[model samples]
Target: MSLQDKNIAMLYYGEQPHPAHTGFADAIGADFICCNPRSDGSKIDSPLNEFFNGFSLPDYDIYITEGSRPLYSGIAATIFSDSNLIYLGGDHRLRELSLGGFPNQAQTDTRYLRTRSKILQFLCQHFIDGAIAVSADSATFLQQLFGSPSTVRTAKPYVQRDVFKSLSTLSTDLESKKVAVIASANRGNVGDYKGIDMLVDSWPDVRNHFPDLKLEIVGKGHQAKHENTEGVRVKGYVEDLDTVFESIGLYVQPSRLEVFGVSVIESMVAGVPPLVTETTGASSELKGIEPALVVDPNPESIASGIVQYFDRTVAERENIAKECREYAMSFSPDVRTKIFHEEFKSLIDEIQ
Candidate 1:
C-alpha cells in the first residue's frame, strides 16, 4: 500500500481535522493525494492545491469528491482529468444536471438553481462513477437526484483515540458540581437553537432540586448575562476543550437539528454524561449507554432530566461515567479507520 501504488485523489472543502486523518491513512500506503481549494491560508495551507498546482492527476486510480454542492463543483472539472470518479456524498444538483433535469418553475428563478445548474454541468462532463453518502437521508436524496450506485450509512469519521485520551485526563469527581455545554453561540439565539434559553428558563426549577449545580457554557455566541443565576458561567471559544471538559459533570445539547453531534461524542469521550435531543445523531448511537439522557428541548423536560441525574448517588454516577467512557471508545480512530478502509475498498470495487 505504498503512497505511489494507491494513486487516489481526494476532493474536499478544506483540510478539516477528520478528513485530514483519512488523508493520512491513504497517504501511508496508497497513492493518496488531496485537494481542498476552499481552505483559506488563515487556518491551514491547502495541501492538495499546493501539490497539484503544477502536478497532473490522470495517473490516479480513483478520485473521491468529499461532499456535495459548492465544494464538489471545484472538483467536478477534475473528474474528466481522472480515470474514475466517486462522490463521497451525493450531489443533488450534479445528479440532476447530469441527467439534464431542471427544477420546478418556482425554483428556476432563484440564484441557487442557476449555480446548481453550472455545478451539474461540470459533474455531467466529468462522468461520475458513484457516490457514498454518510446518512440514509443523504443517500436517498442522492439516489433521487443522481441515481444510486452503492451506499453505506456510517457516522462521519472522527478522531476517537485523541478525544478519548483527552477525556481520560479530565477530573470526573461529581462533587465538582460542574455542568457544561459546548456549542457555537452565533448559530442561533441562545433561546432558539442550542436550547441555551431553554436551559436558562429551566434553571430555576433545576436549582430548586439541585442548588449546587454550576454551569459552564463553552463556545462563543451572543448570550445575555443573567444576573440572578448563582453558578452559571460562560467560557467562550476555549482553546483547550479537554481542560474545559475536566470540571464538568454533564454535557447538554438542545439543538433543534444536527446532522451528527460531534460534541456529544466528545463529551462521552471526556467521561461526561450527555443530556441531548433525540434528533441528534449521537442520540441513536448513545442509546442504552447509561447516564446518557435524552429529552425534548422544553424547559420542563431539560430540568427534569438534569434533576434525575443529580439525584444519583456518587457511586452510581461513577458507574454511569464508566459506561460512557467504554461506549465512547467504540468510535475511536482505530475502529473508524477500519470501517473507512472497508467501505472505501467496497465502494471502489462496486464503482469499478
Candidate 2:
C-alpha cells in the first residue's frame, strides 16, 4: 500500500477548534480527535472529519500530537505508547517567548515554577518518536532542546486562506474602523503578552494624526472590563467578522511573542495589510509575501506601524488589497495539505 493509505490520528487542545486543522486532516484523509473535554466529538460527518472527545486511540498507524504539556497531551502519549507517534510543536517553548524572547528575564513568575515546568515538559517531550517543527525558530529550539536535528521536519499549520479570500471580495462599510486586533481576553497574564494592553495604550499616539481613526479590539471577556479609550473600541467575542475585515485598512498583531499568527495570514487574505511582531512565525512568512511592516509589540512601535496606513490613498489601498489576496493564496490549505502528507509519508518510510 502507498504511504498515503496509512491510518493517522491527531490530538490537539481546544474545545471549539479551528476548522483549518480538521481541514488539514480531511485533505490527508486522516481521522481527527480532540483533546478538549467540551468538544462534543463530531456532530456532522461532512466539513469536519471524525472528531472524538475520547482518547481511545485504537488501531491507528501513526498518531501526531500538537504541542506537549497539557494533561490531555500526556494522556495521548500514554494512550499510544508504542505506535508511530510524532509530536508536532508550533511553539513548545512558548513561555520563553514573553518579554522580548527571554522568559528568564521576566520577573512575573517564580524561577522555581518555570524551571520545574521546563524540566517536566522536556521529560515528556524527549520520549516522542519524532518532532515535527512548524517554523524555523521552532526547529532551532527543538534541535537545541533534544541535541538532535535529524528527527525534526517542517510542516506549518497554515491559515485557511480561501475562507478569508472569499470575504476579501465582499462589501463592508468603508467608513468603519480601519485598524483591528482579535485575540481572546481572560488570558490572565498572557493577555498582556498578546499586546492587548500595549495596543490599548497606543491609541492616543495613533489617534493624534487621524482624529476619527478607531482601533477595534475583538475578542471575549475584554471589552467588558476595558473602557473605550479616546480612539480604541473593544467588542466582546465576535462570532462572525466576515464584513468587518472587508473595510480594515491594517491588521496589527503586535503580540509580544507568538509562535505562529494565523490572523496575519487571514487578514492578508482579507486584503488588509498586516503589521506583525518581529518575533512571530507569521512575521517571517509576511516577509516573504510583502514587507508588511514588522514591528516590536511596544506601544511606540505599534503606534508607528498603525500610522503608516493612514497616509495611503484609496487607489493605493485598492491596489495593495489585490496584492494581499494574491500573496495570501500562496500559503493556502491546499499547498500545506500536500506538505503535511509528505511529512507523514517521509516519517513513516523512515521508521517502518
Candidate 3:
C-alpha cells in the first residue's frame, strides 16, 4: 500500500487544479492526477484529467475528494466503488459538518437544506475509508465527522515560499506605512467571515493612532463604497499575490472561520509579518513565529494588533522584519512536500 508508484487521484472543482490539492499531488509524485469533472472536452494540460467524470475512471490505487458532494454528485459512488477513498473536510466547513450531525455544532443552520445535509451526512459518515486533515483542528473535526478521530492525518497548509521570497525586498519608507489584506472576495468581503469588515471598522481607530496609516484590500469584488474611505484603498482581483506582497509591510488575516490561511503564509515568506486569529487552523503553526500577531477577530482586537506595529520604532520594526523573513524559510514548498509525502506514506503503510 505504499504510495510509491501507486496511482492516486484527487477530485476538485474549476478548470485549473487548486493549489491545496496540488500540494497533495506533489506529495504523491507524478502518478497523482487532478480530476476536474466539469471540463467541456477541451484540451487540458497533463496531470489534470478532464474525462474522468462520465467515462471509465482510471484504476487509481487511492482517490481523494473534498467533503462536499458538489463536484461529483452521484459520480462519487462510482469513484468510491473500488479504490481506497479518503474524504477531506478541511475547508473549515463547520456549518456543513454541523448539518451532518458531526457534533461540532449542536444544531444545523436553518439557512441550509436539512434533507440534503442529512443525505450527504450519511455518505460522509459511512463511505470514506480514511481522511486527511489540513491542520490539527481539522483533524479533530474530521475525527468527529468521520467517526475516526484517532486515525486521521494532519498536514499544514502549503506555502510557495521561494516564489514569494524571491519577490520580497526591503520596502521604502512610504511602503513601510502600508498594510495589505489578500483573500478571495468570497472570503474577505467586508461583512463576511474573513473579517475584512472588522479590519475596515477598526481603520478609524488605527488612523487615530497613526494618521499616515494606509490599508489596501486586494481581492475580487471589493465594494465601491469602501474605495472612497479615507486611508483605505480596494483593489479587486489581482491574479498574482507576489505583486501585492512585495511592497506591503504587513498582512492581516482576521478570519472568523478558516481551516487554513495560505495567503498568510505567502505573506510571511514575502518578508511581511502576519496578524492572524486563533480561529484559523494556521494559527497553531503561526502563533509564536517572530513578529506574528494573534488576536480575536473583532474590530477592537484587530485594530489593537495593527496599532502594535506602529508602536515599534522604525529600527525595531526592521529588525523583526528580518526575523520574519528567516522564519518564512522553514515552510518552503520542498519542505512541505517532504513532510506530507512522509505523512501520506505512513498512512499507506498503516493501511491493510
Full-model lDDT, candidate 3: 0.66
Largest TM-score belongs to which candidate? 3
Judged by lDDT, which candidate is best?
3
Tens-place lDDT digits, model 3, residues 117-207: 5665566656556677877767876776666654578766566655645645534341478888876644545446676777888899999
Give one digit per residue, the lDDT tens place, for model 2 in 194-253: 777777788888888878887777777564444557767776677777755866777788
Clashes per model (N, Cα, C within 3 A):
7, 0, 2
Can you list the residue pairs that collide in candidate 3? Answer: 143-149, 219-237
What lDDT would each prediction earn against the true structure? 0.60, 0.64, 0.66
Rank candidates, TM-score, best first: 3, 2, 1
Ranking by lDDT: 3, 2, 1
For candidate 2, the C-alpha RMSD (Å) to the true structure equals 5.9
Candidate 3 deviant stretches above 4 angstroms: 30-56, 66-75, 78-80, 94-122, 168-175, 185-191, 239-243, 290-292
Segments in model 1 whose C-alpha atoms lie over 4 Å from true places: 1-6, 14-61, 78-149, 153-156, 160-162, 184-198, 221-231, 297-300
Query: Roughly what TM-score does model 2 have, to 2 decimal places?
Result: 0.77
